[model samples]
Target: MSSLLEITWTDPVTSRKGYVVIDTLVRGLASGGLRLRDGCTLDEVRGLAQGMTRKESLVYDPADRYLPLGGGKGGIDIDPGDPEAPEVLRRFLAAVRPIVKEQWNTGEDFGLRQETLDKVAADLGLASTVEAVFAILPDADAARQRLAEAFAVNVDGLCLADLVGGYGVAQACLVTAERMGLDHERVTAVVQGFGSIGGAVARYLAAAGVRVIAVADRDGLIRNDAGLDVELLLGARDGLGVIDRAVLRPGDRTGPREAWLDVPCDLLVPAAMSYVITEADTSRITARVVVEGANMPTLPEAEAALVTRGIPVVPDFLANVMTNAWWWWIVFGDIEPTAASSYSKIDSTMRRLVEAVSVEADRTGRTLRACALQLARRNAEAVTERAGVTG
Candidate 1:
């Protein structure tokens, strides 16, 4: 029951392609991240936009109600290494100028960053920053300012990318573990991917006394039964999330970068790229719980196998609800995000969401992913009903 609209524009002069895929527009507005990657395609944009719809609308209901925002995604297909990248982006932006004001809004994603997008957004003659391109309209800007006012900060101070998804993943792991009756203070976990989201989650989990027994980055996988020193590994990690093999100690175990799948622990977090887990990985997935920290990390066959084996595959849609929750709260309520309180808010909300879904899953004897999909589907129904759009 996913919905979408695909818009593609190609600059004749630059030969660069731009895309806007709106999964469904609630109240005539759609929003999501804008990604930049080489070889980007329309199908990929549609998939991401659909994920965005699920992420924003799913409220763990029949657990709770929520404000439904339709999902949209933007993609610019061009290599960043090209010397004419800026010019190419300008041309692409111009191609979509009309719709950028009316139909869709976007923020940075994948190869893009909010700071860089904000700095360069002016060239596109757009009021929205690349971080939050769709929020340029007066209503959206006023809403952001209200969020700022709640936090007693300036309008320009808010940045959703700081810790939203990463923090939620860690919090959900802890809460999910507890819901399974693993009430101990120190739960062990193995994480794949060592970059921004992965690193942030690992750091937070380690600090919270979760034994991060193994870590995988682009360079290789490192394991320690007694738990790796997250701080030390963080220091050794490169920009690409690659940890140097030389940083390993004498007794530590090392394997291929993808060997993280074989590590035994109470929790497994796939925080890297999509579809890392396939049918082949099911045999090696020893962890009791698989918390998806990335979009579509587990393939269909692998997911079914895990669920059939009594393993809980927490879907990305439910695990990464912090950002959407934050946005919903600020716009619907008075709470504004602040440096000091944002972490606490994300932690509490994530714990609540994970617990709710876990409870429902336990009661219904269903996989966590199934429970999430149920909630997302129901929420989509609510949106369609309220918006008076015939399904």
Candidate 2:
């Protein structure tokens, strides 16, 4: 069910090749992030969608308003640095326009800018990641209130924050650290990737007193035993999360590709791309815990190795469900919550959910991935079955 669509598109202007992948759909809706990267493939999109599926169903509060949504992911294979990026985006939107809608909503991932999403909206479309896709629309609340007055279904102005996903991941890490009895203020963490998600995780953890010892960006890996300053690093990074090595303190640079996997720390967060951590990387994984910040960052074999080695690996779907809660509020909350209120709500709930997940994983002696999957599917199926009953 991972691959629902694999379409190859030829640009009408440049005759360049492009692709789109729809991983899965549920109840006529499918949604996930759309990434642009060199060598990106349908298989990678499919795997990411699978995690999104789990995320859509991994309910923390289980209120009556929530329901599991289908998972869908999209990606385009292209040089992200192409000068004709606008044309590329236009072509992509045109190609995907026919198939994307209430049934298929997509949003930004790596190598994509918010302007691209604006382009999509200009074409009369929406973006749905783990949260309500309508949040990106103009005046989301007015649209919703108008629809409510009309007794209609209009999701105008449903919106999401850029850091919602990363915020959830940080909370998950904190929960894991707390459950393991690790001192949060003294935790040594290595974060791979400096984009929105990675930067947010680093900032959240660093603010909470975790020492971010290593940060691997597009340019290179930077390390500081005294803990790299997350704020300083964020200030020095580019939009793509590439670090300005020149801004670093002396003797704090790991340079490019210098064994990021073997760095000893209390936490290792793979927030970059998929398959970054594989079976071979396990032997080098010295962290007490690994919290996924990216979809499918760890291969099955690598996860198995961690489980066998008794290291708790917080699965991606479980660790990154912040947007799901937000979506629930967007569609189901009695009243709309402000950005700050929504984040505060998600943060507190995320910690509790992760704690529950960790406790259950220990009780079942299974990986966080397994526990999350079992619970998500179980809950989704139950709701599905209930809806099918005759009145």
Candidate 3:
């Protein structure tokens, strides 16, 4: 029989409920984020937890023999955007504080913030010793503040990965261009999200001399043959990463929000949300390369259609896991001897991971998704074996 999946938590204060899905726990503990969104469901949490397990395995493979830490995730189905949402969150945390103190580690996810996490930690009297994926909180109150600060830091650093992933994508595109004997100078790109990752990618690609002909966000799409000023667009971008509609001058304006998809380009990156490239949109994509910057931005069917068209796709799970790995190392205090050395280590690791995926895909004639899964499974199996001996 398979091991039973266990998810347990409660609201001691208000009797409201939350849950922790422990996907695997071979290492000393499991780790994942806490999401508070209205549409979050138990099944969704379980799937995400499983993905976390896979991500951990993929990143830590063939390194030090760290047992699988197990994948864990928790969430509350609440509208975090609501005005009185803070109070609701407080109650939710009051009920689950004890659980957070004990076995299940939680961090911020979508629709959740550090300020609110800090408040929850304070209410539960969780000590500062409790660490999230980013930093260590010295006490409950400090943890609360740290959570907030960590979140701020995450948002602030959003621009950092912009160049990192963009550079990687550009490098990948360059490689693909070389292999296909395509003209690199003529390559144009469209960024389908103006958020940090999307905007950063656009900037980095433009800097590398790739013409970013189009960019879009929640409000609208902007296009210019001469290329839009990435820095200026970023300056005008709002907190939610949406570009202000007022900035879209008549010359820069596209027909509608969906016009971004139809913009002819050599590369198209969906960095905004999941399932953006659905079946209906797949027929319209003209890009030769698609790099996913968001988590699961393309549905399986859409991905298949792209594959059928011979369009190379860089898988989202492979491309985005580096950020999580970096945060994990920082939170775990697993830095190198020197600060500069540590930063270099992280960069090297990310580059190597991306290269490895690309190489494996080429070698085996398999998709990046297949290669990443194979790598993850190999590591997970090893972790599972170690757990059997140790547990």
Candidate 4:
């Protein structure tokens, strides 16, 4: 699908590039996340926007009040660790303020954080990063309050807002395990990336009896034959998702970052940057399944190679749909802003989605992504029809 609109801006001061892609629109609004990374490109942001459309459609339910909005994404090319990162982000946000105010609702992704986005948005005098959706909400004030309350709810020392997406990713892993007839306790996982999504996925999978044997961050890889201490590592992570080397346990093994795909495990989750797994890298994959915890983490050729090897891959849109859906579920009154309620809803919904995708894939003898895209497109059409829009 072609994007409805695309913008590329070059920063005046640093000449850095920033991009926005509004892939589709429903009720005059679209939603996705803004990412900051050293090598971010317009094409990457465009693909992410398309993924957001699929994610929004895959979560659609006629019974729910949260009608899925279309997909949009923003990206800026600057290392988040750079000293000038804040100013670059400020200028990028300022450059796109009009779009944010009118139609695009974006939050943090990849190298970006929610607090940083919020601060910048506020600095630009915007009411909220997602204020665009408020225009269509029945009661904007109530939604604002409810969303704030939901974000404030803490679970197990981590914010509920941060845990929801990774919780869904873990749920997808568990569901996939059940379908493959594997014992969850004996299954091992190797997760690439230790950021919010990766950290949370590791935590929840560990809690569910899965032994996460290896986890890779930007610095290097941490491995333990038995199982790494997920809680300790999660607490030790910095804002950029890098773990402190001082926190390594006596039994833990450290290796080069390039060795992530070499680790033998039952499930492999790439939760880091996009396209890390190339066609050549697929040769080293020993996992039975590849669950994408990051958006567009695997290249098409790599996925095709995995398919030839009979490794099932759970697409990113379905696996990591929780965070985006959670916000809408709360804002649209389909769910209350409480931990119990949110957890219950997310679990049931994610389980249903995973099962649906698996069954469809088996029935049609197709890749999981193909079946999922079919489902998403059908639902998207229905959603568009219901919204009285044509695209």
lDDT of each: 0.72, 0.71, 0.63, 0.92
Write candidate 1's Cα lDDT for 1-391 as tens digits.
5455678888687777888888877767666777676777887788878888888667423233234567888888876556776676667667766666666656556555555565566666665532233343346666656554543542223234545667788888888888877753568899998766787778778878888999898677899989888878877776456787777787688889888998889999998766789988898888889998877789889999998887879898887666556555555443445544566667766776677677888899988877777877777887677657521
Report the number of the highest-lDDT candidate: 4
Residue 103, candidate 1: C-alpha displacement in angstroms:
2.8
lDDT for each residue of candidate 3 in 1-391, tens digit (9 for 90 to 100): 1222555455454433455676766534566667766655676677667767777777775454223355667777666666655776776666655546654566555566544575677766764313432132234453344333433433233523223444444454555555556675677888887765677678767766778889988777889877777777877887556787676655575657778888888888887665578877888898888877665678888888888888878776566554455444444434432334334645566566667777888899888788888888887787777556421
Candidate 1 lDDT trough over 10 residues, lowest sum: 151-160
Q: In model 4, what is the error at residue 304, expressed in angstroms?
A: 0.4
Q: Stretches of candidate 4 above 4 Å error?
A: none
Compute the lDDT of residue 110 as modeled in candidate 3: 54
Instruction: Tell me the deviation in Å of residue 297 in model 4.
Output: 0.7
The 10-residue segment of model 3 with minimum total lDDT is 128-137
| Candidate 4 TM-score, true structure as reference | 0.98
Candidate 2 lDDT for residue 284: 85
C-alpha TM-scores of all predictions: 0.83, 0.86, 0.76, 0.98
- Tens digits of per-residue lDDT, candidate 4, 1-391, equal 6799999999999999999999999888999999988989999999999999999999998999999998999999999999988999999899899999999998989888898899989999997899999988879999999999998999988888888888889999999999999999999999999988999999999999999999999999999989999999998999888999898999999999989999999999998889999999999999999999999999998999999999988999989989899999999889999989998998899888888889999998999999899989999989988999733
Give one digit per residue, the lDDT tens place, for model 2 in 15-48: 5556666555555566676777777776777677
Q: What is the lDDT for 345 in model 3?
A: 49
Off by over 4 Å in 1: 9-18, 37-39, 60-66, 76-91, 130-142, 146-160, 236-239, 244-254, 331-334, 384-391
lDDT of candidate 1 vs native? 0.72
